[model samples]
Structure formats: structure tokens, C-alpha cells
Target: MDKIKISNLEVFCNHGVFKEENVLGQKFLVSAILYLDTREAGLTDNLEKSIHYGEICKYIENFMKKHTFKLIETAAEKISMNLLLNWDNLEQIDLEIKKPWAPIGIPIENVAVEISRKWHTAYIACGSNIGDKKKHLDDSIYALNQRETCRITKVSDFILTQPYGDVVQDDFLNGCLELKTILNPKELLTCLHEIENAEHRERIVKWGPRTLDLDIIFYDDLILADDDLIIPHIEMHKRDFVLKPLAQIIPYKRNPVNHKMVIEMLYDLQK
Candidate 1:
């Protein structure tokens, strides 16, 4: 990844905890480092291939002047998200907001907040065994794509698979999808849960039956285990239904926990 830096672009805005501070604007210095691939832009001498710093500066100025927030942290977070969303080629951003004038009634050089935000690649497994199985799966995908913080990159064809667990239920329609999102692991899980709830997914039966079942298969090669969720799906490497659809799209994607690719897992399961 390459970097484009913008430093100390000053803006006069009303952002403070004090009432008078909001009435009388204060000076703020904003800086940013944008991460993206600039090699093609350099080789082709095309501005379109790269992010424009001049335009970004203007955007920052306008954003600061237009929005009023009590905390600089909120401003930084909003700015970072907006920049990444607006610029299709931008992969990550480091943003900082500095306030030179403080209402704390103390001698201070400056007060600032800095944050780094980036897009993460995640793989999800979709399954449904109850009524309207295919529609449940499709609707789940649609719901995720409708979110501004998430984008569906690729989807595997849904395949019929025997249900897992000893619940003795109907066959399930299963598939996998690749997602690009700004949400973290927990936040992503919450979003998925919301979609499942919308489809009337029941927790009464464990693998017995469901309208929709959405699981996080992999999240940026992350290995996580908590009370609520586990990464690499815990048993993904041992499940044919999971590996089969996953292999169709990203056979080479390695499991962080087992250090095995999706294709390798599928082969091992078959044997």
C-alpha cells in the first residue's frame, strides 16, 4: 500500500463542550494519511487512478464547517468513514483533529484525537432448512448488501446439503459469501443477528430447524474465541457443506487457526 499525506489543514468550526465555544468558533487543524495503491496512477500518469489531495482538502474543510459536534473524536470518526466510503479506491485512513483553543481554563498547547480505520475482508456462511429456504438465504444477502458499512463482494451458488447435528431435519440450502466491511467482528456479528431475527430465526432448536442461519466463517484471518462467537467457525474445516461452498469462491483462503486452505479442508473431509 502507498500513502498520500495531508497535514495541518486548518478550519474554523464550532466543536466544543462549552456553550460559548459553540457560539464562537475555534480553530482546528486536521491531518490525514490515505492508504491505497498508487503504482498504476504513477505509471499511467492518470489522476483518476489515484486519490486527489486537493479535492480531499476541500472536502475536509467543508465537512468540518458543515457539521457541529461536541467532541473531536466524533468528528474524526465521521470524517474517516466518509472519506473511505466516498473514495472507492481508498483502503484505509489515519485521521487526526487538533483543537488549539481549549475551554479548560488552563495553559495547553493543543488537544487532539487521532484514529485509524480500514476495510476488512470477511467470509460468511449462509444456511436455511425451514420454509422458503432459498429465499431466506437470498434475503439475508440482500440485507447485508443494503448496509452502508458492508459490501457483498462474491457469492457462491447455494447447494442442497443434509443438515448437520442429530436433529433429523429437512435438507438445508447452504452457501458462502465474501464481504468487505468497515464494521469490526462484534459489530458485524450484531448485524448478522439482526438479519436472522428479521427472518424469524428461532433459537428453540439447536440445528433442529430454522428460517435462516448466518455464521461468520472467517474474518480477515482473525482467530477469535469468546462466549458469543468463534472465528474460522470452530468446525468449518470439518464440515463439507461449509468447505464446499467456501472452496468454490476462495479455495486458497487459509484458516488462521488450522493453517489449512479451504480446498485442502474439503479434500480431507472427502477422504
Candidate 2:
């Protein structure tokens, strides 16, 4: 990744907790560091292949002026999201908002907030065992694709597999997807849950039957474990249904927790 940085660009915006602060407006210092791959532009000397700082600055000015929010935190968030969404080449952003004029009775020189946001690559496992299983799986993929902030980069063909665990049920149609998302892990989980609910998925038993089941197999090689979610899917390498499709899409994607590639995991599970 390479960087293009901007410093202390001024904007006059009405954003504050005090009434007069909003009415009179105040000066704000906005700065950003855009992270991206500049190799294409560097090789060809093509401006088209690169991000235009002028346009991004103009967008920041216009966005700050057009929106009124009480907290600079909200302002920073919106600005970061807007830039990430509009600029396809921008892989990440580090933004800072500085307010030189403070309404606080104390003599503070400035109030500021800084934030970083980036796109994450995640692999998702999709499975269905109840009613029109294939349709449920396909519908889930369509739902994910519809989100503006999420993009489906690759998909494995749906494969039929026996149900895991002792609970007897119909066979499942399972698949995997390579996804690029601006949504953070928790946000992405929420979105997946919404799609599962739409398919009338039920969670009566652990590893049990369901109309649709969507799990985050991997998220940017992140190893995370909490009450609601687990990365590398908590024994995913032991499950053929998961590894079969995962290897199809990303055979070389490593599991940060186990230090094994999808291909290696697939073969190891088979034996």
C-alpha cells in the first residue's frame, strides 16, 4: 500500500453543541491520508488510474459545508465513509478533524477527533438444509451483493454435503464466497443475520437444521473469538463441507490462527 496525504485543509462549517456555534459557524482543519495501490499510475503516469487529490479535497469541503452535526465525531465518520464509498481506488483512510474555535469555558486551543477506516477481505460460508436449500443459498448471496458497501469477489459452486453433528436432517447445499466489505466485522455479522432471518432460519439446536446458515469463515486473517462469533469458524478445517468450497475459491488463503493454507487444510481434512 502507498499513501497520498493532505494536511490542514480549512473549511467553515456549522457544527457544535452550542446554539451560537451552529449559527455563526466555525473554522475546521481537515486532514487525511489515503492508502491505495499507486503501481498502475506510477508505471503508466496515468492520472486516470490514480486518485485526484483536488477532487477529494473539494468533496471534503462540500460534504463538511452541506452537513450539520453536533459532534465532530459524527462529521469525521461521515466524511471517511463518503470518501471510501465514492473513491474506488482508495483502500483505506486516516482522517482527522480539528476545531480551532471552542465554545467551552475553558481555554483549550483545539478540539479534535481522528479515525481510520478500511476495506476488509472476508470469506463467508453459506449453507442450507431446509426447504429449497439451493434457493436459500442463492438468495443469501444476492442479498450480500445488493449491499453497496459489500462486494462479492468470488463464489464457489454449491456442493451437496451430509449434515454435521448427530442431529438427523436433510443434506445441505454448501458454498463459500470471497467478499470485500467496508463494514466492520460486527456490522457484517448483523447484515448476515438479517439475511438469514429473511430466509426464516431457525437456531433451535447447535449445528442443527436451518433454512439458511451464513458464517464468517475468515475475515482478513483475523483471529477473533467472542460469544456470538468466531473466526476461522472454530474447527472449520475439520469440516469437509467447509473446506471443499473454501479451497475452491481461496486455496492459498491462510488461517492466521492455524498457520495453514486452505489447500493444505482441505487435504489434511480429507485424509
Candidate 3:
């Protein structure tokens, strides 16, 4: 959407590889583009409805002076995360960290790192078939809500469903959750795995039975594939347990691979 740009603002901070660089400090120029919806603030002329650029500059200045890091990369990472966490209305950040003074002998203009970071919308499928199935599912949602990088936006009511794979086990309580997350796909997967292990989940017979099963149904519009994880879950549209809940919240979300919306998939499954 809309953006507020903060051009090259100079600040002196101690961030370098050399020992003296940390002691003496150097000049750094930072530029940031803050993304947000300005319609509310614009219409009302309300300061509270918008992010204050003046205050943000002051925050940046203070943070630069307070922390001493060996590399600008580290500083940029922390700053971006902090901005996203602190500014509720901000949707994304485009940041550039420029270092004018360099040890290299060549006369170069500047060395800098530019990066883009944003909160991604993710949908997760959670199920449990073993002991305390509902409890396990609820606990996993609680755990995800506690993380700073993850915010649980919505959760579907648990539904009883038969076990997907061939195994002599009890029916599962399945549900879906929508989240706004700053964590990357891999990082989010790791967090899910951690929650599963905490609930004593097991993977003996390939989705046969478990205390908790968490799967990534969707992450933004991303189409990702790896040995350990896959995005836009490969078979989610084909499973009623998955579509029933997912369609509740994101009925219009389209599958990047198949070019079909959740509503279309749900209708197709029922026929």
C-alpha cells in the first residue's frame, strides 16, 4: 500500500570489524521506507492514526548510540525487527545501512546493505489423534500465540475427522489457524516442530498417529518445496478436514500452483 519515506539520515555509531572501529566509532547513513495504510490518518487528520516519522528517527538515533555491534548486518537485522514489532500499523520495511568510511584502499563511494522485510500471512493446519487430542491442539495454538514473531489471528472450531493414513487409531480433532508472522517459512516450521516435540508427538508410520500434527497449509503466495517442508501443503485442497476449516477464514485465497481459490476447491471436493 502506502509508504512514508525517510531519506539518508546521518548518524555516528560504533559498528565495524576492527578493534579501533568499535572504540572510535564512524558515520553511518540510514534510509528507511515505512509501509502502512494511510487512509484512516489521512481522512481524519489524526496524529494517532499514523506512524510519526520524527519519533521513528529519534528511536533510530538512540538505538544506534546504545548498541555496539561488529557488523552493520547485525544492527540492520535488529533494527528492522524492532521497528516491525513496535509499530503495529507498519506493514513492511525497506532499509538501507550505509557505511561511508572503509578500510579498503580503493576510493569507493559507499558500502551498504539494502533489504526488505515484512509480516507474512500464514495458515496452519493442526490436528491430534492420540491422547488428549483437543488439549494437544489447543496447547499448540497457545504456544504459537506466545511467540513474539507470531500472532494468531483466527482459529477454527475443532472438528472430528477420521485418521488420514491406514493405522488402527482414534479419530482426530482437526482445526486451522491464521497467523500474521515475521518468521520466515523455515523458521516457522522449526517453531512448529518444537511445539510438536513438547507435546510428545511421534512420526512412526508416516502420519499414522501422533499427539499433535502441525502442517503449513499456506505462507503468503509462496510456492516452496524442500526435502523437509513444502508450502501451500501439497494435498490440502483434497482433504475435507483441511478445506472445511481453511475455507471458513480464507474462502478466496488462491493456490499459487493450481490457480484455484479455496472456495472453488471446497466446492470441487464436495461434488
Candidate 4:
């Protein structure tokens, strides 16, 4: 990835803990490193193909002036997220804010906060056995799409599937969605739980009936296991419900753990 750097860009904004400081306002030094592919622009020498630094600088100034927060941490977080949300080509950002006029009596050069953030790809499986199954699945998708940090890139058509465990239940509407998120594994799991609970999902019995069920099937080819979560989801390749939808969107996607393509696994399962 190519990089763009903007350093020591000054902005006057009102952000501090003290009431007087907020009212008086202060000068802040902002720096940022934007990560994106610049090969196309380099080859064509076209300004349209790359990020416009001048525009981004003005945007930074406006954004900082538009909002007021007590901590630079919050300011940086909001700025970074907003940049990612508005800019399609930006893949990651490293932002730094320097408070040279901090009210601390102790003599110090400056107080600053720097943070790095990026987007990650994750695949999630959706299932529901009770109530309006299609509505349950649809609502889950809608909720995921509504989250600012998450973007749904693809979705497979819902398929009817028998219950997995021994508990007797009606057929489930199963599907999968390709999600791009800024949240890490644990945070993403938490978001999924929120969506499930919002749809009134119950965990009374193992793999039992529910209004909605959301499971992390994959997280960037990551191989992981813990007391609470597992990745490449245990035995996902063997289950038609999981494999079928996964194959539809990512047939060529390789399982980092199993070392096999999604289509290959689905074919073997079908055979």
C-alpha cells in the first residue's frame, strides 16, 4: 500500500475538560497517515485516481471545528471513523493530535494522543427456526448494515435447512453475509450478540429453536479457539447449511485452517 502523510496541520478547536478552556478554545496540531493503493494513479498520472490531500486537510479542519469533546481520544476516534466512512479508497489511518496548550501547571512540551485503525473482513452465518424466519434473518441483515463500523458486502439467498442438534425443531432459514468491519474479533462478537438479543434469541438449549441466530463463520482466515469463540467455525465445511451459503459468495475463499477452497469443501460434502 502507498502512503500519504500530513503533518503539523494546525486547527483551532474548543475541546477540553475545563469550562474556561472549552470557551477560550485552543490550537491543536494534527497529523495523519493515510494508507491506500496509489499504483493506478502513479501509472496514469491522474489526480482522480488517488486521494486528494488538500481536500482531506480542509475536511480535517472542518471536522475538528464542528465537534467538541472532552478528550483528544474521542476526537481522534470520531475523526478516524468519519474519514473511513466518507472515503471509499482509504484502507487505514494513523492519526495524532497534539495539545500544546494543555492547562497542566507542570512544564511539558506537549500532550498528545495517537491511534491506528483499519477495516477487517468477516463472514457471518444467520439462522432462525421460529417466528417469521425470513423477517428474523432480514432484520439481522438490516441491523448489521445500519452499524457505522460494519459494511455488508455480499449476502447469500436464504436456504431451508433441518435443525442441526438432537433437539427437535422446525426447519431453519439459513444464510450468510460478507461483512467488512472496523471492530476486532471480540468486539465483533459483542455486536453479533446485541443483534441476536435484539431479535429475542434465546440460549435455553444447545442449537435449539430461536427467533434469530448469528455465528462468526470466518474472520480474515484466522485460526483461533477459546472458551467463548472459535474461528473457521468448527466443522463448517461438513455442514451443508454453512458450506452452501459460504460457497455462494466465496467459493474460491480458502480456509486457512483446513487448507482447502470453499468450493472444494462443498463438493466433497455433496459427494
In model 4, pairs of residues that clash are none
Model 4: residues with Cα > 4 Å off, grouped in runs: 222-227, 235-238, 264-271
User: After best superposition, candidate 2 residue 63: deviation in angstroms?
Assistant: 0.5
How would you encode candidate 2's per-residue C-alpha lDDT over 1-271 as one tens digit per residue? 9999999999999999888988999999999999999999999999889999999999999999998999999999999998998999999999999999988778988989999999899999999998898899989999999998899999999999999999999999999999999998899999999999999988899989999999999999788889988887997988999999998988998899889999999898878
RMSD of each: 1.0, 0.9, 0.9, 2.4
TM-score of each: 0.98, 0.98, 0.98, 0.88
Please report the TM-score between candidate 1 and the true structure.
0.98
Q: Please provide, for model 4 over 1-271, each residue's C-alpha lDDT reduced to its tens digit, 9 standing for 90 to 100.
A: 7999999899999999998778899999999999999999999999888899999899999989998899999999989988988889899999999999999999988899999988889999999989999999999999999999999999999999999979988999999999999998999999999999999988999888999989999999788898889997886987899989989999999999889998999999999
Q: Please provide, for model 1 over 139-248, each residue's C-alpha lDDT reduced to its tens digit, 9 standing for 90 to 100.
A: 99999999999999999999999999999899999999999999999999999999999999989977779999999999998999999999979988778999999999
Summed backbone clashes in each candidate are 0, 0, 0, 0
Per-candidate local distance difference test: 0.94, 0.93, 0.92, 0.93
Q: Candidate 4 — worst ten consecutive residues by lDDT sum?
A: 230-239
| Candidate 3 runs further than 4 Å off | none
Selected candidate, larger lDDT, 1 vs 3? 1
